[model samples]
Target: MKIKFRVILSISIIAVTTLMFVSCASDPDSSGLEYMPDMYRSPAIEPYVDYGEVRGRENKDLKLKRSAMIPPSGTIPYYGTDSATVALMMPYARKANVAMKSTHGMYDAVLTKENEYDFALADKNPLKLTSDNMGDLFDTGKKLFTANCAHCHGAKGNGNGPMVVSGAYVGVPDYANLTNLSDGQIFYSIYYGKGMMGAHNSLLDKREIWTLVHYIRKFQDTDYGTSQSAKALEAN
Candidate 1:
């Protein structure tokens, strides 16, 4: 009788100890026992979010279903009302060299038998600047630069952007050193990426890229395009 009583007592002690440990270790009001609390919650619908489960509950039918797709080739986007802007947005006449197929994955692009990137040196920036619109253009340029270039090219165009400072990427050249690059060549490099950089044509439209060219030129020549705008405003 004493042995059975001792066994029951031992079992009760173990149960009490377990309950106490659990209660002390976790807060019932909080995300109880979750090592990574974010793993248990869905804050928003992300393109890459795995919606298979939420907080230990599994039900695909309850989650938002997303389908991935790419736009078809040769489909032109609406370039808006400006005739000059529309002309500027037309397809680039220059072609990438045959080596681009293996080097830069220009498989989908029309490749050339010879090197044509060199020809881009003759190209000029079509987006002329004047004092009347220079201020607004730089304002637009600043927003575009922050959104696209600042992360990799640094806020000051010194090539020490956060990605470089954090060691996530390397070998980003300073804009000041690239003074010899023609405006058109700069456009080409961004449209069809050069070296390690990927093509940005899909991400940025042609008009936006030209605006960036004007902004980038400011790095090489601090007073670039400003005088033109100032002169135009004064003349007007």
Candidate 2:
């Protein structure tokens, strides 16, 4: 009886080893041999990563149809409550200049017959910098800037960012020299992007852009938001 049991155990071990080798030697394109096929494909949506295949099944419909598409017209995204915040985030009243249609790729956007950049100079920053929230705003602005603007604008807003210093980019202007620009014009430039820069409105929301306007003000004036006089000079 003992010899019979030992023989059966040895045969079972050999069979399992053979199965393991066969499973490991599957076809390069086949996921059918996987123990848990679901684990092979990422459950999370990853940007730019193809999800057209899973468990060796090729899904033609899952392939990306288009990398990007323009948003439909006459639609506005909800910016949430806080009337003041919503009001500040509302679409700019002025339209892009007609010349910018070709120059700035404002073809789908509402373009104005006249050059509207000069008109933007009259617009004011809606997100006011009060003494109470000034500290928090700047902190948030710094984080946003570091992530978005620092590469091109530099940490000091001096136009000598890593991109410019490395010779990969040019035409980025210094913030100190841009003191003449109104808060609204700055917002416009950032929203739509200006001179070699593309539209960042898709990347950044309105509230965040307004905060950047305040932060840019800080670059020009170190004592920004500390005095009413400074605010008076900036309100265009």
- Using lDDT, give the best candidate's number: 2
Question: What's the true lDDT of residue 93 in model 2?
Answer: 75
Model 1 regions more than 4 Å off: 1-73, 228-236
| Count of backbone clashes, every candidate in sequence | 2, 0
Candidate 1's displacement at residue 17, Å, is: 55
Give the alpha carbon lDDT tens digit for every residue of 28-78 in model 2: 776546787658767776565566765667879877644244457776668
Count of clashes in candidate 2: 0
- Check candidate 1 and list the clashing pairs: 130-229, 131-229
Estimate, for each residue in 1-236, the C-alpha lDDT of model 1 and write its tens digit.
Answer: 99999999999999989966664544556655566657766566556565667667777785665533345877666789999878888877788878777877788888888667788888877777766777887888888999998989999999999999999989998999997788888988988888877778778988788889888877777767654444233223
**Regions of candidate 2 where Cα sits further than 4 Å from its true position:** 1-62, 66-71, 232-236
Looking at model 2, residue 153 earns an lDDT score of 92
What Cα-based lDDT does every candidate model obtain?
0.79, 0.81
Error of 2 at 225 (Å): 0.6
